[model samples]
Target: MGATTVLGLARRAAVGVAGAMGLTWVVRAAWGIPSAMGASVSAIAPVAVASARYRNRQFHNTEPSTQVAPGSAVSLLLSALTRQGVGRPLGAIPLATPEVPERAGALAVTWYGHASVLVEVDGYRILTDPVWSERVSPSPVVGPARLHPAPAPLSELPPVHAIVISHDHYDHLDRETVRELVRSQDAPFVVPIGIGAHLRKWRVPERRIVELDWGASYCLTGTGPGADDLVITCTEARHFSGRGLIRNTTLWASWVIAGPTRRVYFGGDTGYTTAFAAIGATSGPFDLTLLPIGAYDVHWPDVHMNPEEAVRAHADVCGGEPGYGLLVPIHWATFNLAFHGWSEPVQRLVTAAKAAGTTVAVPLPGQRIDVNALSPQVPWWEDVRRQ
Candidate 1:
């Protein structure tokens, strides 16, 4: 091509790139800015600030957890730049169409990918971290998108007794999902301290919102609805929270869901912490445990747990016998959030579970695992990604 033609082509390419970037910025501004930003700090802070975990206007983990260390940005950048197939699956991931019966079994869990789950504990249904939107970000157009489609639509889900939110991070607390749930379902949203402000900003009714600081509990009753008097307690998680520039303005937590007969422990997202055993002693010996087993890195060990850590946490939650509770891993296989091989999380989890004598159910996204009749540990993820 002639020099003039080449120069013209380059100029057009540059302009196109610039235009794309500008459009992205505009979309983020219009859609990414959370409606909850201006939520009442008083509504969120009073209880949290009073807790021992609260200090300096932020929440802290019982066991000092760190998000990132000094001079780690260079390593993160390097990892991102050099990362090759680490963030994606080699083959298509299989999804399952979960069957939600009219009444949930004694104790069951439907893994909807990542941290989202539908727990059926002693006939009550609790949906945890339901992120049905395409992306888990402030802007639908600009965040970590789902790797696989949700097996079923939100409307398809059966009536849940309650919706439990762990924190205010974009991934765990999605605005659109919450809005739709408000319109469709009558169940109350149970969240950590201060997260109620975000829900209020999103127009969730005050009656349908229940906020609690760590160690607080809500008893639901009626003998016919809302878990028939199931108890949910906000428990400590070793992590930080933020939906925007302000970090720890809200609280992050794990949860203890106790029914009359069975109990479930949800380890939302956390680094390995010393409080696990304490949680077990206070409110555990759970029949089922949903824990994070993905998005772990050597540098940020204090934020997300590895598979091995998850197993250890499971045993702690089970009060010693790791094999006592049914384990279903979460926070992995749904999005490309970290620099690890797509299947590495489960692989490590299976190995660790076996070593720890913990029984784990590796259900495909949307697949439900009845904690009692637990299926054999089939390496389903391996079927897709051949070595």
Candidate 2:
């Protein structure tokens, strides 16, 4: 072969290799690192089938149909992918606390962004819906990435007595975070009924886990010699759950943590429903309520509450009076799971809470609120979104 012909063939080969390399990167980033489908498979493939079977039964019991239409769902999916109309990026807000304060009977809450909260009450520290993963989706590369970094690393957290999971969604029941929590702390895993299956699959020992159905209560009686038995009850929430493709195989819930002196409620996630009033009537007038306030859209109004509905839920949980104890909002500022402006949730909640005479404390991401002090005043999120 001529020398010129050999050089031309070499150039063509190089171009082909470059093209292949570029394509591979895109594919990897789109799909996540592969996993053993066997674990999530048993629970995954059956979802669409289960959903179809339960469609009629679910609709008959649920509120007037407001489910998102197929076309709308497609539109939303495209918008999220393109990030079109996404507003200015909101930087992480700083939280300054000289030291973590000691609260005996008082409840302390540390917001770890979006549904993850560390509640210290009655000398026992309990963590809830802990999601420290980089993304909320099953894949690490695509889907809704975290809007702000975690307030503190999971390893740096104070010793927890228990880790409670509300359900088995990717955002709420992160496999990675669960493994980390299991390794870092010796806390028992308290979860709703079917969620134990997920934890067990992840290699958590059955001895260190407690599974509860709705209305079931688990008491943490003295683990050692000098421990108090605090009661955590699984309360009903109007929400659905699924990690991969399936939905609602496992139950979702809110928790009522009661002690001898103080009682607090953690509303994991829910839509606008009359059940809140029932909860308040039955086990409330609570000292504090950590409720979700973001990732809401009109498509799934019955599944997630907007800012206005959250205020109402607050009042219902506190007996129609917003002036009760303290209100610290969660489920916002962490993950970009929805299309609304990053700061939209807090902005709307502030106005509604103020008009209703509710006493609210919007703490920085990592800051801890005494629930008694309610210190570090002023709306910091306001400055962030306005920019």
- At residue 147, give the lDDT of candidate 1: 84
Count clashing residue pairs per candidate: 2, 0
Model 1 clash number: 2
Kindly list the per-residue Cα lDDT of model 2 for residues 112-196, writing each as its tens digit. Answer: 7788888888788889999888887767677677766776778778788788887777788887888898899898998866677
TM-score of predicted structure 2: 0.86
Tens-digit per-residue lDDT, 205-248, candidate 1: 98999988889998877375453578999998999988777788
Between which residue pairs do clashes occur in model 1?
Answer: 44-194, 220-229
lDDT (Cα, 0-100) at 142 in candidate 2: 70
Overall local distance difference test of candidate 2: 0.75
Q: Which runs in model 1 stand beyond 4 Å of their true positions?
A: 1-25, 36-43, 225-228
- Model 1's alpha-carbon lDDT is 0.86
10 residues in a row with least lDDT, candidate 2: 52-61
